[model samples]
Target: MSAATLRAAIAAPAPAWGLSAAQIGRAATLALHDELALAPKPGLVSFVDSGSHDDMDAHTFMRSLFSLRRYFVRMAELGAAQVPFAELERSGIAAEARMLAATGGINTHRGAIFVLGLLCAATGAAQALDGRRDADAVREHLRRHWGGALDARSQRAPTLPGGIAARRHGLRSASQEAALGFPVLFETALPAWDDARRRGLSAQQVRLDCFFSILAVLDDSNLAHRGGLEGLHFARRAARAFIEQGGAGQPGAPAAAWSLHRDFVARHLSPGGCADLLAAACFLRRVAREP
Candidate 1:
């Protein structure tokens, strides 16, 4: 479908007022920015620290995020049109090029570009159809529309390190996760965030709880790539321990989280995949809050 057709379809009458594609796209972008700005991210880049990645800092992430603004908008537009999966793949490739250029050939936010871009599109598609805008509905739209395509894409030979690592380690690739409608995001990360909020936890505490929840469960290839099976196991155990100890609800949780962060940095392990899911959780939470 053409972009104009998508815009027109999206402009059609819908239920109670909701965010437009542009607004959804912008919210997705800001969600990513918020994730980056979140400090003490446990070996992940934030506004105050570099985490485990010396190659990319918070400034580098900002540039990558800025470069992706139009890409997210276009992805949302494509979904609004209900375009073919091939078209979305083509757009993603182009956006990756822009991301690489913006980051001066570095791979900052590549995973996020894929995951969050799909979400932006799925959200737009749902809204265009006047469907529900909650997390389950958006994810259902993704599965109903693109599950097969995503599965087929996952079957293709590996290209990037994350994909290669996933294949070599028998972990799920990002495409597979998308094909499954992002079970980790829907079942794990979002619930963890919501549970923390329901418990009246602080924002940082909520994020901590959510991140650890993701870490304990997500088969993060970056962690595998950096520290192999041993590193992945260690990270999961640490996160699991944190969660069992009442997480952020515990009085000493912040200190424990900091200790885990230091350990991750020392081992050069970064749960980048989990970090992406955390950002996605934020995006979905924002989408759900809209009228």
Candidate 2:
């Protein structure tokens, strides 16, 4: 479908959301500015869109995957420093890491952004790109971590459901090898499925490809999980107020100034729904724009 058509179709059904897609769009735009030297934190809950023609391009898909992987690593790093040694609960980073580890091991096939980033970076599409500093570095880093490269790991193969998503789409994970199966259902799995369906690739593929494809984004770590936890030394009681408050509206409606994040989604986000980060901003945009 054409880009314009794609936009309309995505906008339909829920022209009104709980927040501004533009707010998250701003975050994405800011990330592209490249000033932060950190991965972009567009803050859209789910960005992978399988139903939208514009978003299904392999390149765009790869970048979105890459972006999420980078963010996961960055969040882990940032939260780690916040961890307080004096008290086990003091460090935000440590606590988050621990939580992730407890929930699922970090750097594991399911828990690792490194594995996903490495896969995208290694792809022919990624290699063909001109300015892929992040991709390039990630590939090299994965190589060092794994006998000079990241490949499928037979040990952590996804379950029947997880395997179906990656297998159906011919998707490969950097950390996972065809030899070993990916074992568990990673958190990023669900979001990946929604993105694929939204992008319209659902028909072409089956089984969700949650292990490595855009579906893998659910594995992409964020501060919200840790932020939601209690006993954080700093930024405690966030209430996840940032995302929760986001509201939505119908097309052409007047947006109230609920929050800045709303506008951020409208301008930058595509119709990723709640499976991606744009959902948060879009919710806000809809809230502000709606009467």
RMSD of each: 1.7, 20.3
Please provide, for model 2 over 93-195, each residue's C-alpha lDDT reduced to its tens digit, 9 standing for 90 to 100: 3433543444333221122233222222222112122212232332342243333212323345555333344444443332353112122222233344345
lDDT of 1 by residue, 64-148 (tens): 9999998888888778778888988899899999999999998888888889989988897788776667887788788878888
Lowest-sum lDDT 10-residue window in model 1: 10-19
Model 1 regions more than 4 Å off: 2-7, 10-16
246 Cα displacement, candidate 1 (Å) = 1.1
lDDT score for residue 269 of model 2: 28
Best by TM-score: 1
Question: Each model's C-alpha lDDT?
Answer: 0.86, 0.27
Candidate no. 1 TM-score: 0.95
Give TM per candidate.
0.95, 0.23
